[model samples]
Target: MKKILKQVTKYEKRISVLLMVLSLALIFNFCINSASAASGDIIYVNGSSGNDSWDGLSAAWTSGTNGPKLSIKNATGTVNSGGTVRIADGNYNGINNTKININKNMAIIGQSQTGTVINGTDSAWIFKIQPGATVTIENLTITNGNAYNGGAIYNAGNLTVSEGRFTDNHAYVAGSAIYNHGTLAVVYSSFLNNDADGGYGDPAYNFAAGAIYNDGNLTVTDSYFSENCAMYGHGAAIHNNGVLIVTGTDFIGNSVYGLGGAIYNDNALLMANSNFIANVAYAAGGAIYNIGTLAVTGSNFMGNVAYGAFYAPYISTAGGAIYNDYGGTYTVDSCQFAGNIPQDIYNNTEASSGYGSGVITGSSDVQGATVKAANKTMPLQKTGMPLIGFISAVLLVLGGSAVSKRR
Candidate 1:
């Protein structure tokens, strides 16, 4: 009987220890799961019939909040899980003066692409993402903004824009449509009729990049830049001072005054399956101006024009497709340059005058050691827009003498 009691006590002790261990394990598991959990809310905004006092919950414009400001403010305050702001199909005006500032990790999505619009009223930017923020915008249109740097959107953090249109914006300095000081990814988007045409009289004023200015990592896929203009600067389409990778993008009808009618690259740039067509530059590089490492693969350049101002200091056309200067190295693989005016591939690195254009490589036509053509053939794409800005300046300079003689 004593041995039986002792055995039963031992079994009870073991069971008690096991139960305590199981309880501890269950508590630890619960704590771990709670610590890793995520929670947030989805907010709504309606522009046409919303009011500022309404709660951002209803999908109908009559009951939802009018603008994006309050919803963004609430989302930034939320902890753990990030927030999402869904906007309805209507024209929206930015709140908090002239711009809608975002300082949190949030997603702004539109109900429809063609029906949802964000208008800046030609006074401010539509969206400004601050540092340490992550934002994603999709299926919307941003238009009619005016600013010094970014007219439509200014990003100082990580930003992703998908399936959107940025049009009819103007900037006085750089990036008429968008300015990025951080990581930016654009997919299936378009930048049209944006102008970076201010800062004329100041000697330091070089109005660069009618569409975008990137000082950080930039990735563009299946995007388009069309009918953009830069008045006294370079890169009517894009100005890149950092790493840029463009795949399946198009640059059409962009114009500039100094160089790079389509793009100006000062750092690492890689373009694959892209198109540059009908771009005009008053000085050089109707397609691209590369001051850094540039690689173009499976791209096409068609009908690009590189002309000089007849009455200005520079009076020659060079590099109707690409003006590679500043000891910049470029590799063009399986790329085609067709019907480019004046010449193709203006290499200024090996100039006889030490500052002018240089020898031809892989082509039959050598125009007096001034312009070179890289013999290549490929197809092209088309975008709707008439060439205006810098080409008009070139024609005015050339035709000015004839008009004066007639007068």
Candidate 2:
């Protein structure tokens, strides 16, 4: 009986030790998961029937069923290191009928490019990224947004957009699609049919960018800008007051009344393997207006038009593809210009008012080519004449080319 009691006690002690070990293991696992969540965690957002108050636990999400986190805002918590919010396929107008503000380092990803749509109201923007934040948005469409600066997004932080579309947005001042006061990188994205019209205010207030206004670093790759308009402002597609880099992109049918139908660069620009087609500017540079350091290589410019103002019909209109001012420095290489109205290259500060020292040609490192700049006889065409010039203008306007008029 004494030996039996000793055996039972020993067995109970072993069982207690095993139970304690198991409890410690469970606690360690929970701690590990919680630590991961504090850093770069993944949260699910279901658009169908998810609740905002519940935590995004794995068991809470089922196939085609609601998740714990319903909206993007609910998914955005105090994850200081960084996190990802996996959004399901649906049209999200934003949480609580307001703009989605991102004040942390996070990434918001959609299930599919076309299936996820973030529609904005007429009062607020779709997304507003605060300063010192790093945010990545992918596989989404930001449409029907409206604001004073960025109709779709107001970014004062580092932003990266991939495989996204910004369309049908309107801004009262600048950046109908995006206002970047910080670093921005765009890949395989598109900005289409956006407007920066000044919204019935003084034209002076609306000064830049119909598609994007960059006061910081801007980089774009494999993107497209189409039919963006800036009324009484510069850069219908993009206004770059900071560093700008564009590669393998296309700017088409953008219109501006001030300068740069496609882009206005006042700082530094590096454009390579891009295309500018059917862009129109009322002042100068139908495709690009450069007043700073500019570099263009392996690009194509076609069907671009630079028309003089209707009131000042005799105004000096030049550079159907590119206009380089006195303060601008340009290097063009391996570019093709075809069917551009007026001229292919115009140097405003040139002694002869055509291509000159403002633009450099072939060098030891650079191999340059061009269609040619127009002579004095081309710029002398009058509207009163029913000659080739009048016929060209009529055909240009009729051929789906955007036209801008400046007083």
Candidate 3:
């Protein structure tokens, strides 16, 4: 009888331990389920329905208590314009169907572009900014958003960028860092090592605009674009189809397959107190390929090359350094265009197809004070105006600081 009683006691102890383990497992499973359900909620990208979510203190988005916690963690989710999504800081290294669709005013505060990354791989761009939507981005270090156009960001409407570093971003068509069709303004923004290498994609043309392929109005002030490259055609740094204004900026190490290693302007290009250096091109205009009128005041374009079409190297060659094709003209003052090697200075109609117009040593200073320079007007958009400021603020928060916003 004693042996039998001992056996029963042993079995009871084992059963009690099993029951506790099962209870803990059930609790953990419930918690995970709840967290996942919470992350699946939808939000807007940047449009507004006349309602703002950045102001007002609310936690739960629905009841205005505890704002919903955003956790993707290799999971799939959709972002419209509704609430703020906190990336929680980690490598979103998979193709997680994660998107910020333009619907309402939305803000995505990721830790710096280098630390907190959103790899929208397995498809196209990491963040695809849709048309007719206003998007504001800050403190987000976004890269490897591979697409034929707008590798990192493909904007169709109004985009304001501040304090973000678009590095190693690429596009096959145009605007490796940003392919803008509507309007764009970059203030205090740094675009580095973004490539505009056009390949055998749709249309298959030279659309690689190192930093931007602006067909509309583009305004860049107090920005830095360096080591950016383009495949074929104008303005390795900027292939502007409309108006472009540069103020207090730096363009360095920009290259092109054809013309305009530093800049290729088709419509109008204007600059003030800017610097362009160390840019190269395979064809004419190692520093500038202006098919239209290129104007600058208080700017410097030195250490540029204009390798002429001829085989012999002319160290003092001028036009090769600055090529203005199809009757392109320039009015520059207080600017430097030395260290250029051009086949001819201007009107080398015999050098095959390219006809360089402006040289470093000659041409207009102010074809008159007030000319039809590239329209320096930036696209009008409210909420986070002057993209550079917002970019800086976002970088501050993303550099490992925990984000705790009330709205």
Candidate 4:
């Protein structure tokens, strides 16, 4: 009996050791999976005939290839909550409303702008973001999507775009290429050849903003806006109904029919170290039209034209570079308005006085271009970062528990 008991004890000890080894192996495997799910901080694409890498994720998406081709949807995107969604170098195709909505605490990074493309043309936006969700779209091309408001993108949360092309998208009414109602940050992006009919479009109420429309806070840094045509009226390149901050951005070769050849501001617009060149407005405001506060500092406004057959004091008027009417104020500081012919600043009617009466020059009382200088130096914010510590900590805790079991 004593010998039998000894044998049983020895076998029990061996089984315990085997269990510990198995537990340790599981812990190690889990750790490796947690870290290796996403390769790098970026989504890489090798070569492209202008196809987005997100297309690869769509192949694995549950939508079965026929639905909106999304790299990450609500289901799969929720996996590895902090993991990144990578895209290979390939052409991704979506008709309309084919967007990768970033609702999780993750990032959707890209390889290069020249190697990716998002081509969608339907009734919904190509990229749509919800609130509290941060997303960054870098080094890609987004075009040919359709929305009632935002053609290519509609952002309700914080969004940032860097080194990409936004071109040839068409919105039903407003914001042909992009419509922003939340915080927007743009860097080194190119807005080219988007079309939106701004409220006087054919068939009535067909309005569009060729390049962009912002109803929230917007900051453009070192970007270029060109070849956007608002055939109906207002904001050939941009229509801003909220706060617009432009720093070191180039607005050139844009056309608007009614007002603001390059831009139309119904609210606050601040331009610093920017350039508005070669823009044409058919009715009024060759380069810019403001119905609210328009501030310019250290910016260049050159070669803008207002092509109007008949002119009115406030209606069908023309200004070389700028025109403001009814409760709008224009402030200039260290800004060169030369080569912007036919009176740089034209104010038709003011809340208190007539045109040109509301403009307050840099008198001895005001020192310099405060508004312009501030916007010019406006810092670009970074967005679309996930809560990396939260999920990673949880994973670590699980792994540690498994390791302890082994011990």
Candidate 5:
């Protein structure tokens, strides 16, 4: 009886070990499947040789049922929320009859900025980010879009664009390249040759915002805007009815028929370390037209032109660099304005003021006088040292010697 009892105990121990092993195997299999699901969240889109019916799990074609999707639409639809859609280097066109709607938080990354192109073919807006969505687009060129409002992209959600190029997009009303109704951040991007012109048979129609129309919060850093035109509108490059912050940006060769060759601020605007060169406006404000609050610091404006026209009854030309309209509040700090045609700063406000080393040209009409200095220097921060002092310090650090001043 004792031997039989011991043998039963031994079998019971063996069964317990077997069950433990089986449980561990099942747990390991489940973890593997979970990891795979997480890894498969990223969908691939290859415009050249891809099939839409296949699972967009692989970058290259592996089998008849598993490969990259053909279009961005398919990849976007297949990707999970907060997933990424990787686009190959190819031109993607023929978007659906309606726009490509993105309703979830995701990222769309292109292989290269210049190699991966999304051409609208003058059809419709390419991507429409729906409300409550967050999207990030990187390293892509969005071009040739034609729409009545937003040409390239209509963003109603939070969007971040980096290393993107928006060119040759046209709109009839506003925002040739992008219309922002929510928070938007653009970094290391370029807007070129985008226009907001009047439609056919409407030459006298008034449009707005050649490149971007912002009715929400927008921040632009290290970007370039060039050759954008608002044919009969305000803001050749940007029209801001909300908060706008621009830093380390360049605006060049933008033109408008009405006001603000480069930017029109109807709400609040802040610019720092930016350059406005060769922008033109037929009516007023060659570089910027401010009807709201504007603050400029450490910026340079050169070669901007505000050419007046005799449009039937009146001639209006003012503010080659900036036009502070009546009731506007503005402060220019450590800004340099030079070589602007007609004037540099035209202030029609009651209490607009400038501080620091902000030097206006001889033709500026601010407070019925101009602020000009013979030995004008670049705009430097009040707390920052001069360039010569900085150079000397660098030399001392490098050579461990005192440098003689040559006057």
Candidate 6:
């Protein structure tokens, strides 16, 4: 009788151990499922081979109506706030003739910069970020957008752009690439061959900013601007009506028919470690025109020209490198200005009005600017593994541990 009781007790212990293991397995499974659902916050967009009717929960097509979205518009509409939208490598054009309005905080990431393209096909604006929204765009090419203002993107809220290329965009009024009314930050981006032409009207109309127009705060870092043109306007590369900070940026081969080949500042402007090369201005300021406060440090201006007819009767075609308008304050520190046609710096108050009102301070090398070759090669970095893959690896480890304990 004693031996029988001992065997029964051992059997009960085994059953209890098995039950505990089963409970643990169930709990782990549930946790894994919950993690997967959380990962669904990331929506996938595939321009090709995707169905709109299916739920955009999976990166690829799965059985029973689960797949990526057909267009970025649909994904944006469906994604939750602060979610991410991953776009595949394909040309996304004609998906929406109207602008894609974003009103939520989110991120739009592309597979690659050159491979993933958002071409407006010269139809309409590509994106519009509404007020009170924060957005980030990365690793994409925006091209062929045509609009009255901001051919590629219009931002009324906070925006950040990285590893992006804006090319071949056209605007009728201003900002062929981007128009910002809120805070904007551009990093590791390039603006190329954008044009802002006064459209089908009197040449007297004020059209400006071939690449970017800022009415709010703007910061640019490690970016490149090249071959941007503003016809019958000012500021071929940038028109700043607000505060602007530029660092480690390059402006090359930009031209303007009016004033300021590379930049026109009506407010506070600061530049550091920037380069301006071969920029042309028809009126004044081959590289920069400042009507407010301006400061430049450790910058270089080379081969810039101000040679065309003056746009206004009072405006003089001077200042191949910089033009400080009457009543403007300027300071240059450790700056180099060389190879500029006609002159290097022109203070309008001293030359024309004789007001001597504008304050010009700091030392600059105007005789011979140090020439430094720019290295323009920038490659994109790879991201980490997907969420699903991570979850699977964790589940595998848990399963192996459970099996070992049971053995």
TM-score of each: 0.75, 0.76, 0.63, 0.68, 0.77, 0.77
Give candidate 2's whole-model lDDT.
Answer: 0.72
lDDT of each: 0.69, 0.72, 0.55, 0.61, 0.74, 0.73
Model 3 ranges off by over 4 Å? 1-89, 97-99, 111-114, 120-123, 200-204, 309-321, 343-407
Our tally of clashes for model 6 stands at 0
Task: Tell me which residue pairs clash in candidate 6.
Answer: none
lDDT of 2 by residue, 162-238 (tens): 99999888888889899999778888999988888754347567565889999877788899898788886789999
Per-residue accuracy of model 1 over 311-363 as CA lDDT, tens digit each: 24224546788877745656565677666767767666444534432222233
Candidate 5: list runs displaced more than 4 Å: 1-40, 96-98, 198-207, 310-317, 349-376, 379-407
Model 4, 284-343: lDDT tens digits are: 787788777676666766566666533454343467678767666566555555444455
lDDT of 1 at 397: 32
| Model 6 lDDT per residue over 77-146, tens place | 8899888889999999886423799998888899999999999888878989898777888999999988
Highest lDDT model number: 5
What clash pairs does model 2 have? none
Candidate 6, residue 228: lDDT:
87
- For candidate 3, the lDDT comes to 0.55
TM-score of candidate 2 to 2 decimals: 0.76
Runs in model 1 lying further than 4 Å from the true structure: 1-39, 61-81, 94-98, 310-317, 350-376, 381-407
